[model samples]
Target: MINIFKIAARNLLRYKRRTLLTSLLITVGVVMVILFSGLSGSFKQMMIGLITDATLAQMQIHKKGYVSSIDTSPLNLNLGPKAYGKVRDMLEKNPLVESYSPRIKLGAMLSNYKETTNIRLNAIKPDSEIKVCPALPDRITFRDRESGQGLINPGEIIIPDKLAKGLKIKQGDTVVLVAHNKEGSVNGLNFTVAGVIESVAGPQGKEGYIHIKDARDLLRIDKPEVTEVAIRTRDFNRIDMLYAEINSALAEYKNPKGNPMFEIHTWEALSPFYNIARMIDLMAMSMKIIMIAIVLISILNVMMMSVYERIREIGTIAAIGTAPGKIMGLFLAEGFSLGLISTLFANAIGVGAIYILNIHKITFSFGRTENLLLSPSVNFNELIWVSAIVLLVSIFATIQPAYKASKMEPVDALRHV
Candidate 1:
């Protein structure tokens, strides 16, 4: 084994130019794959944070038909007083339920003195909203509307930063909101802009949020009419089970016609962006496959050429009683050495590049929000996984070529130039 390895090392060194070129190709392909994987992984982490922590919770409950069509016409499964009371009671009783809040959503037109723009309005309970949507605490600023005071009432409104900029409205500007109430009545309410919010969702940054009570009064919803329910769970991974249980609970409740009216949905069901994240992951895998193919081709071509060039030398060694397995081991050792060197170089380059990018605070602009594109930063576990994959691909790529070289007839090889 030692002799075979020594011969292989000597042969590689003998053809310095070809060996270096092959190693360089492998190194380049490995580095590119690692870099792209790191970037893709970072983006995925960022998206997860934006969706799970910043925006959507583990599960959401909406009117039976609201998930399919978000029409301006009154919500079909409007959770009235009885339904709200019952659902809330059921959720509180469940051990999986960490917390939940009622949300009234509407599409409305907001008008300043000079301009009007469409907006999504969310009516939320102040304390409950803060728990479910933690980003709200950092995004909104409070200021009193009267006497230029720096404090605002709980009933005051908070508009998105994008809307505030587009409408030329500021902290004290009064905006008029026009929307259909729960009873299909058209109503208008003037609200003082107490603060501005920034959100990952582009439309969210143009939407306005107000206290649920204020919204109920403005929209003239005399009875309970929450459009949706936002739910948080003790464990996000157990969301499917929780959703099933909630559905079962809701099934126990019957409408006047004796049928279930409520539908349960997980955060993944409600958010289309999560599907986009999965697609991105698929794309990253495709890229890695392509990179491996390129590296494999380069390695195979180099090994084949090396075998052809060393035909006489291989035949001489075989004729002197070197075992066939030993001959194959020589080529495999060469391939392994090349892969090991390239892997090390690639990992170093990839880690250094990621560190520099993170240090510089490189960020990508996403819709109306600009945030750090990488989350969990550069993870060591990912690096180790990628490195292992690269090594396995390298070994597999050389198997056929090495086997072919080992099977060559000594007499024929010795006769060749």
Candidate 2:
């Protein structure tokens, strides 16, 4: 076996140019696959982080009819006080739930002298808001001008930075908010702009936030029923478990219409952009597969031609009593050796490139949002999986050609030359 390997190594070295070209092709393919996989992984991480950390929690509980009727006024499928207590209690007891926050959302139109934009006014508790959305606390300063009170209070609102600019409104300015009450009556209120917030997910600078009490008073709901429950978990990957627990708790609550009126939705379900991200990932993977197939075919063709060219040499060795199995081993070893070397070189090059790009903050932006840039990073587990996949693909690509070379008849091969 050792002698056969040495002979195979020598043969490959004798054809250094051909061997180098084949190796380069394989190396290029492997490098591309690794680089693309790294990029895709990074994009997925950024999207998940943005959704989970900045916008949506892992799971949400909403009044059953809220989602379908979101276009309508602020009518709450109101989880009554009893239901709220029950659900909040259950969430606190659930080991999987890290924290949960109550939110009331109202659809209202924000109007200044020049422009009007429809906005979803999320009513949030300042303390609980920080736990659910880590990005919110640092985003803006809600304050009262006369009393110098900070943190959003009743009749104060925070508008997204982009929306604020478009409306030509600034802090301390007044804006008109029109929304429907639970009784389906339209009501208008004037609010002082407490601050301006920056958000990547909200309507291109069109959304606004206010205190829960303010939203409740504006909508004329005396009891202030919450429209949604945002839940944070110790591990977002356990979102299914958290959803199940919350749904079970809500099962006992019935709405004003005497219908079970609470629904649980995961972040992926609530955010349409998550679906788009998934589609982009699938497309990228498919493209990588196609590229690998093309490279594999090239490698196979090169090996086959190399084998035919060396037919006389192979036959001479076989005629000198080299067993068919040993002859087969030689060709297989050559293919394996080539694949191994190429994979090593490709991984080194790919990793180096990714490292450099990440360190330099190479970015691609979308629209005016800075967070839309691609982030490139790989965790240990992903690296292991990607390396294993590359090795398996390289080995698989060598099989058919190796088998063909292994089965050639010495007499027939020699006669052909």
Candidate 3:
């Protein structure tokens, strides 16, 4: 086996230019796959982190029909005091749940004395909200930084910066929020502007935050009713498993019709950005397929050329009693060596490129957020998988050419000038 590989290496070196070109092609393909996979994977993760950490959390639970009617912010669909108690208890007992925030979602009309506009509000307990969405506080601008105050206090609100700018409102300004209760009765309350919040989704997002107690008071809800529960888990990568477990646990709690009263969803289901993530994944897969095609074609073409150019040599070896399988193995070994060497160089170059990119710190904007950093990294498993695919494709590509050379008649080959 060693002698066979040594012979193969010598043969490849004899045609160094052709071998170099083939290896170069495969190396480029592998390198492209690695770099794209690393960069795009990093981008996807960063976007997901921004969305989840900013407001959405990794998972959420809502009344079964509430999400369908979410656009309306239906107060009637709220999880009542008793149901919320049950959910809170369940979450508290679950080790996987890092934190959970109960929010009272409301659609209200905001008036800055002279102007009135619609706004979506999430009323939350500041402490719990911060725990579930750690990035929530970072989004607040124009706050009393010296005081180290919470995101929102009772009788205070954090309006989106765009809304504040449009309304000519500033921090410490007074605003009126008018909303209707589940009973269809109108109520309004005065709130001090705590700060302006930077939009995460885009400029169109008009979500504002207020204290949960204030929301209950304005809506005249004596009982604790929550519109949704945003949850953060300890292991985000295993979120699907946690989602299933939570759903199964909640299944035991049914409504009068014996159907589950609650529904759980991951960040992907809650955010529209998931569509873009899917597109990125599709593009990554397409890149891998193209890499495969490049490796296969390049190896196949080079191996066929090798067999054609060395026909007389092959005939001489055949006449000297060299086994057909030995000749086939020689070609296969050459192809494998080419693939192995190219893959090694490609992995090294790809990793170095990724390292350099991280060192320089690539920054780009997503939606309204600016200067977000991209940290591209490829895992060991991904590198191994790519190498395996390239090597296997190279071997497969050489098989036909190898067989053709092995079957050449010694007499016929010697006759050819």
lDDT of 1: 0.74
Residues 1-417, model 2: lDDT tens digits = 777668767877888998888778877876777777778778777766666766676777876766776655345566667667777888888888888889887788888856788877788886676688776545565544444354577888888887787778889898999888767789888998889877665321335688887877788877747877888888877778777777777787776778886788887777766777789778767856775675567557766876878887777878888777777777777766666677778778888988987887766654354656676764556456555655566556666766766677778878974
Q: Tell me which of candidates 1 and 3 scores higher on TM-score.
A: 3
TM-score pick, better of 1 and 2: 2
- TM-score, cand. 2: 0.86
TM-score of 1: 0.85
lDDT ranking of the models: 3, 1, 2
| Residue 314 CA displacement from its true place in model 1, Å | 2.5
Candidate 2 positional error at 9, Å: 4.1
Best by lDDT: 3
Q: Model 3, range 32-88, lDDT digits (tens) per residue?
A: 999999999999988888788887888889999987788899999999989999899
Task: Write down the RMSD of candidate 3 (Cα, Å).
Answer: 2.1
The TM-score ranking, best first, is: 3, 2, 1
Q: Looking at candidate 1, what is the lDDT of residue 36?
A: 75
lDDT of each: 0.74, 0.73, 0.90
* Worst-scoring 10-residue span by lDDT in model 1: 144-153
Each model's TM-score? 0.85, 0.86, 0.94
